[model samples]
Target: MLGNQKVVQAFAHEADAQEKFEDINEDLRVWSLKATFFSSITNPATRFVNSLVYASVGIAGAFAAVKGLLSVGQLSSFLSYANQYTKPFNEISGVITELQNALASAARVFELIDEEPEVPEKPDAAVLSNAKGEVSLEHVYFSYNPETALIEDMNLKVRQGQRVAIVGPTGCGKSTVINLLMRFYDVDSGSIQVDGTDVRHMTRQSLRTSYGMVLQETWLKSGTIRENIAYGRPDAAEEEIILAAKEAHAHGFIRRMPEGYDTIISEDGGNLSQGQKQLLCIARVMLCLPPMLILDEATSSIDTRTEIKIQKAFGKMMEGRTSFIVAHRLSTIKEADVILVMRDGHIIEQGTHDSLISQNGFYAQLYNSQFAV
Candidate 1:
């Protein structure tokens, strides 16, 4: 773990260094190109001046030699030596300038290649065999920065196939809890265990493969509608893609498109409505069929009518799966098995919706403030 932290710090430092080097190198190249052009013009002028001097000397010598005042061999030798000397100097000067510029470019390119990855997976870490989705956080502590704790001494657990909702004000560490569970960032102290196995001991790829996520922002690559839905399982049969889309209530809009399943989606799915995009994201997650699902503000951006439709789709998707829903809309998660109210890196209250409402504590206040709307 110490080695891993060192590697992460080193990689971050290298990335910063590379960015600075590239910026400086780009400025150097531009200046070098202009310098080369000017040097080309200046070098010729210097050679021309040398040639004129040589020519004047040759003419004077030839005239004197013809009058028996100088020698033909001596004049020929002087002209030959001057041409030989200036030619090499002009070529070498240009070569040196060009070499400096090329060196700077090469340095920037190699620096980036030399950088290590920010997060490195262990070579022989165990692959999760059958994750039961039983997660536990024991006295967990975490912070994206050293001075402030995002989650501190927080303890929680969920049984297999449990549906939990985390609701709180923005920046109260609701997402941080999900990030910790996903192992996106390691805890500063304590342990996060999944199915009795410490999450840190599992390979990142296998750990993440156990859970599926649908974010508020639906990121769709430029591709056919069928391709986006089948993103999680590219080899899924055509019928499977159609089934998942239908479950998400996205089939109607997709069918109306000119090409149906084959319709091309613009980059980031810019052609689709916000609700349609969210539905597609849900469809993609459904195709993966992970044991655990994470919905991070999954319905925040859509219209109320569309939100209800997507929420229904989420209900169907969460059946029999261990699900974690992070949202600000309390009504959307009223049916969750457990609700956690967080504030300033701590879980201030947790229970079923009815229980928390009866307590009239932090959770009750939050619900009354927002759900009353």
Candidate 2:
């Protein structure tokens, strides 16, 4: 049952599912034949046991009659009683195999119920409300394992409607300062506050709703284009959906399709290019227009020329919204209000682009290396 969801998410496609189905179907057929073979043999086996019991009683009766201890009519009646007893015994013996299979299935269900969840929700948790887009993280620390730390003693403050871009080399813990901001994972130490309320104090659902995210790993359900775009804002009108698509530079491509916004998208966007899928994700977030935004730029698949146009669409989306951007292409983040340069899970340098360039620090060196040909 869980495997079906993985197939729908495109970890495997329809062809793979078909192959698995045929394999399981063959196994089922063989198993059914085995059961039928056992069932067909069961009645004969019971009759053989019944005949043996009758023969043993008859031999004793013959001995008694020959010794003048019993009559022929009495011996026949004894044999008839033995046959009546075997009939009920034979009926019960037939269902033993089926009953064992049912008990084994029940045992599996009990095993699953005994397992515990990793993170249980807290009772009496409050709901986050009236988020004004201000986010602050102080003295944060986190680690996936005890031997290695991913984030340590991190502190940040962002006022409302600000754009902060994080840039770093590989393995620098650039796993979305944005993810932390949205409370995807809780920090081991320190507090993450949005609009002066700590995230842990509120329900995760309500807190996440206040933010809109567009990451490189874009996700959309298998449905019409319009449905994918309006996922976060399900009640959005057609005009609003089109406006959002236009703002994200997705409207043009969507219109040229055979059915426009009504066109169906295959799972994991098998029918669209990576760039096109990313644009649809952006459109989805735009429709919700959350007060906070997280944008992770995965530009490796995007051509330099194509990215220039996409960045323009991003600029308009970021306007007047508190956003955190993670980018490898330094050019896309040159205009950020603050650029944080991270190294090995630590923030090494931070400032505006020009200011960092003036310092000739880590940010400057990294930016120069990108253009070194």
Candidate 3:
């Protein structure tokens, strides 16, 4: 009885094991079937020919050994040898083909890794502290390409918290000034100073942390609306996020979103209108609460109604912070404390809106061409 009971227990265990094996085999079969279908579609001719040759060669060799008048030992040895040779040949062919593909992929990946970074940080760069937004450009010369100069010997200075507007024709390099200030590209000559310290002597990260930038192209990642707003300062509280959004005039539309703050935004915020995307970008910059702000055509893409809302938000954001506005819209910068009119990398005119119009120079011509209507 004891022996019988032990046997029964062992049989039960075996039955359970078989059931588990069958489930796993089913899963493997499903996976293999999908893989085979994909492989057939991708490499139909080669795979089919390889299979056909392997099968035919294996069968023909076996048939010859079995039917031909050969001694048992000789037949066994021949079959074993053929099997060994064919197995390795098949494996080697597959490995060689895969190795070629892997090498090609590795080459492309390594090329990217080998690329020299455009901006190199200094080994002993100083960290910036107590930045009061005083900025100066001393004999600054910059060129995007070696053959073309953008700004040359440009001298400008701004007191702390002063609003400066840069206006110019399409290629006059109005935006280039902001890029230089942010150290996006090093100047070919001269120097840019922030709060009396040369910007180049400060760590890039530390220098940029002092300013917030809003560009024409608003970049929004795919995430919850709150997540997008809180991106600049991740640890920002829920109330703080809401306040920043409200300040940017984004709270109204955000509240109307299907899930409000929890609403998941699409990449580039494609689901939202262009104006709404800009509002969110403004909100993101506002959340950073930097001491200085750069607005590059911030209102260019928005409708008049949305522009009004954004202008109000801009007014709030500009308070107590040094602001730089780069725009082709003359009306947008009319209220700027000082407007610098640039032409072919040269500042042709600099003054308040009324003063520039009185001078009737490049800026006056631009203003009249647009706003004089």
Which RMSD does model 1 reach against the true structure? 9.5
Q: Summarize candidate 1's per-residue lDDT along 1-373 as a digit string, tens digits.
A: 2335566576776676667779999999999899777757766767777788788988888898899877889878877887887787667665665777689999999999899765676777778856789989999999999987678899988899889999888999988888999998899999999888888888988889999998887899899999999988999998899989987778988999999999898886768988789889888997888989999998787777877877887888788888999988888999999999989889999999999999999989988988575
The window of 10 residues in a row where model 1 has the poorest summed lDDT is 1-10
Question: Tens digit of lDDT per residue, candidate 2, span 1-373?
Answer: 3546665556656677668888999999999999888977887799889999999999999999999999999999989989998988788767767776789999999999888753555787777766778888889888767699888888888988899999998777777466677777778888888888888877888889988887878788999999999999899999999999987778999999999999999878888999889889888987998777888774445678767877887788778888888889898999999898898888999899999999999988998999889
Q: In model 3, which runs have C-alpha deviations exceeding 4 angstroms?
A: 1-110
- lDDT of candidate model 1 versus the reference: 0.86
Pull out the clashing pairs in model 2.
Answer: none
lDDT (C-alpha, whole model) for all candidates: 0.86, 0.84, 0.84
CA RMSD per model (angstroms): 9.5, 5.0, 16.2
Model 3 Cα lDDT, one tens digit per residue, 1-373: 2335567576777676668779999999999898666544544554565667657755666677688755566656765675665565556555554666688899999999999887677788888866789999999999989898789999999988889999988888978898999999898899999988888988998899898988888899999999999988999999999999988888999999899999998896869988788888889998988898899988777777777767777877788788899987777778889899889999999999999999988777888888654
User: Cα miss at 340, model 2 (Å)?
Assistant: 3.1
**What C-alpha lDDT does candidate 2 achieve relative to the native structure?**
0.84
Q: Which parts of model 2 have CA positions greater than 4 angstroms off?
A: 1-51, 61-93, 118-120, 145-148, 298-300
Instruction: Tell me how far the alpha carbon of residue 103 in candidate 1 is from the true structure, in angstroms, after superposition.
Output: 2.6
